[model samples]
Target: MNFANACRLTLLAAIWGASFLFLRLAVPSLGPIWTISARIGLAAVFLALVAQALKQGFAWQHWREYLILGIFNTALPFLAYGFAARTLNASMMSILNATAPIWGAVIMALIIRKMPTFKVCLGLLIGILGVAILVGFDRVVSQTGAALGIATCLSATLCYGIASAYTKLKASHIPSFQVAHGSMWGASLFLLPLFATSQPISTPTPVVWLAIAGLAILCTGAAYLLYFRLVREIGAASTLTVTFLIPVFGILWGTLFLGEHIGSNTLIGALIILLGTALVTGFNPLASRK
Candidate 1:
């Protein structure tokens, strides 16, 4: 990869990684439903403007598909993470995000009615072990609602896995940008009623508004654009390297900005999870270089 693409990859990771921090900052005041609603709502607006600027129009006929994708891919997972952010540290949530591919492999295997390969099975086991270590040993476990938060985050990753499998099964023909843009709109609509019915626990201060903007614009909207560009230029596998990089930035941002402590379990669990992910995806850095 060229130095510029490499930098883009790192920047993408950093932006996405910082999403957890934004969630942690924003969710307390806005609450999960409102936080995620505003996030998808604002991101939809941003992507709409970008789509217009690029003269790309939506395929309105595919609104049903977009709704399904939006619920599974955007709305559910974002809501789950937003809920979890209230109880879990940004670092922990980021590490848990890495489990999406593992869940994807399992979902795919079940969908095809075939067993996973030995490597994948082993990776799945190792990944579970890593999550156990991370959650069981972490200091957060003692906090109220932490267990539920962990479960919520895991459910979020499971939603991502379901979305991936669903895309491959039903929506592969749709362009990536269209899927992203349409889904944000879909998610916004999905969450609109929920946001309307629910009230924020506290009024949002300016900093909270800033956090919401960062989450919506930088982390969700711009990050998707950057991710798709990397996919086009470097192929999906190399672009996926961003997955491994995300948790590193997640932990760093949590530590540096939020003053969240990273115990040894965090490091050990993250490494194990990434190793399991590498095995499951068969992602090799050396192969990408060629």
Candidate 2:
């Protein structure tokens, strides 16, 4: 990656990292349905404005792909995260989020009916180890709601994995902006009934509203711009490294803003997870052997 792209990558990681913090603040108040629905809904509106400013237009035929992505990628995953945020700290949530690529590999293996490379198999195992270390250290298994929260977080990442594979298999031809915009709308649609039934809307404090704005506008909408730009400028493989850095900033943001614990075990587990993901995606130069 060039210096500019490197900068963009770092910014993208920071934005995504902050997303966990936003969820930590907003989800409990808004409830999963309203919180996640507002997030994608507002982000879709922002992206639409930007698209109009850029004189860009997309075809309506991509509705089917939008629905698929909306369900697996946006609606389901965001719903899971909303449930998880009630108990999981921002740092812990980010660590679990790193498992998406590992899940993606497993999904790909199942879809293809073939074994993954040795490195990939090793990565998958280490990724599991990373999760074990975290859950063990946190004693999430023993906690009441925390265990279920962790499970929801894992399910959320699994949804992300499914979305990635589905995108590659069926919708790779669609433009990133279209998929992002349409999928957000799709997710909003999916969450509409849930939003109505889950909770009555209440006036949020100013702080909560700020968190909502950041979550929807900055974390989701603006982050997509940086991500898509990096994918176009650098190869997607290079852009993928941002995933490793996201947890780093996630921990940092949690500590600085929310005063969440950033224990040694959190750092160690997150490092292992990122390392395993690097191996899975061929991000490790030292492990590149014939």
Candidate 3:
């Protein structure tokens, strides 16, 4: 990778990593519906303006497709994760979110009616073990949260898995920016009724307001731009290494900003989870030794 892409990787990872912290801070003040609504709403407007300026605006040729994609990709996941953020800390949520790729593999296998390679099967097992470790020691034993929080976080990742596979099958031809723009708008519109009925605007402290704005603009908007740009520069496969780095910064930001505790179990489980993820994604270090 070039130096520029390296910087992109670092910045992208930091931006996304900080998302968990932002959600943790904002969710309490805005609540899930308003928080996610404002996030997707703001991101959509920002992306739309940029697209119009560049004359590369989203083509609404597939509104239905965008609607479905937005539901899975943005609306549902953000809502579920927002709710989970109330109970789960930034580090825990980030770690669980990494399970999205594993869920994607499971979803694909079911769709194709074929099992993964035995190596990938092993990776899946290790990933499950990692989750068990986190649940058993990090939260369940410590009583930081109950099963509901963990379940919601995992469910958010399930939405991610479904959205990813759906996008690949249905909307691969669309530019990434267009896809993000259309999906954000679709999600914002989809949540409008809920936002109106259930979401009351509350006065948060200026710090919380900053958190909400940062969550919307920086985490959602700029993060997407960085992600798509990296995909363009480095190819998608290499760009995915950002996944491994995300949790690192997630833990860091949580520790530094939120003053969240990072237990030994958190570190160990995260390492195991990333190892399994690497295997699932076709990383084979042992092969190099041979």
lDDT of 1 at 124: 92
Worst 10 residues of 1 by lDDT: 281-290
Tens digits of lDDT, candidate 3, 52-134: 88898468797887899889999999998888887888898888888888888888888878979998898899999998887
Per TM-score, the best of the predicted structures is 1
Weakest 10 consecutive residues of candidate 3 by summed lDDT: 281-290
lDDT of 2: 0.86
Cα-based lDDT for every prediction:
0.94, 0.86, 0.84
Clashing residue pairs in candidate 2, if any? none
TM-score per model over all chains: 0.99, 0.95, 0.94
Compose the digit string of candidate 2's lDDT tens values, residues 5-94: 778888999999999999888876777778888888899899999989988896689999998899999899988988888888889998
Cα lDDT, model 1, residue 239: 89
By lDDT, who's the top model here? Answer: 1
Residue 187 of model 1, lDDT score: 90
Candidate 2 residue runs with Cα over 4 Å from true position: 139-143, 200-202, 285-290
**What is the per-residue lDDT of model 1 for residues 59-173, given as tens digits with 9 covering 90 to 100?**
9988988999999999999999999999999999999999999999999999999999999999998999999999989999999999999999999999999999999899989
Model 1 pairs in collision: none
